[model samples]
Target: MGIEIEQKILGHARDAHPHECCGLLLGRGGRIEQIRPAANVHREPATHFEIDPQALLDAHRAARDGGPQVLGYYHSHPTTLPEPSATDRARAAGDGSIWAIVGEGRVTWWRDEKDGFAPLPYALRDG
Candidate 1:
């Protein structure tokens, strides 16, 4: 379940970096969510990812069409690790948000926990 989400995000992140890539989260039940690219705002996509507010809202609305909410947001740390950077920590995608940090051309996801972002490292599990 987790691994699939990471893979989906990784694909978008790698392709979207060094600009921030965003998308709607799709899935059934509460597992197997997929990341689908929306649109990015940052024109200088080399070291920063800028998401348009309208685009994000649109994505969220679209997800509702599929029975899911925003589920938080994701962006990439180009040429870096999947680990969250200081910026990522300071301006996290919100407390309950799911942060997907894609680097090394891969994806690693974290869930917002009271202790802060907890790694939900991509893994495959049988349904």
Candidate 2:
């Protein structure tokens, strides 16, 4: 529910533009520490995303040193809806982390809270 965190997330997602921007959320208990951008690569069009290994490792280390790390992850959906697609569902990683869907212009975010990836009510959140 803060401007600074929201702006960071939006800025990262926006920076990706047409391509999906992948990253990790670091923080603890509603306190987002950082939004570290990772590899946001797709096999092609209408496909799922794959984070680069090197980028992932770096992110993990960043989270370790930064703060409560591995809060969640983010990626843009480009021309698709905010909802998860079949590919997304299939590729879903049940790490109990949040997932952000950045549409062409709009943005939708979800979080894994025990049950599943539920839509998160937009609010001032960290990580």
Clashing pairs for predicted structure model 1, backbone only = 20-49
Model 1 vs. true fold: TM: 0.72
Tens digit per residue, CA lDDT, model 1, 37-117: 767666666666666778777766777777555665677777777787776677664566666677788666788766678
Evaluated against the true structure, the overall lDDT of model 1 is: 0.67
Per-residue alpha-carbon lDDT of model 2 for 1-127, expressed as tens digits?
4556557667776777666667776667865556667776667623456777787777678667864667777776766787777776766776667777767566577875555567887666443
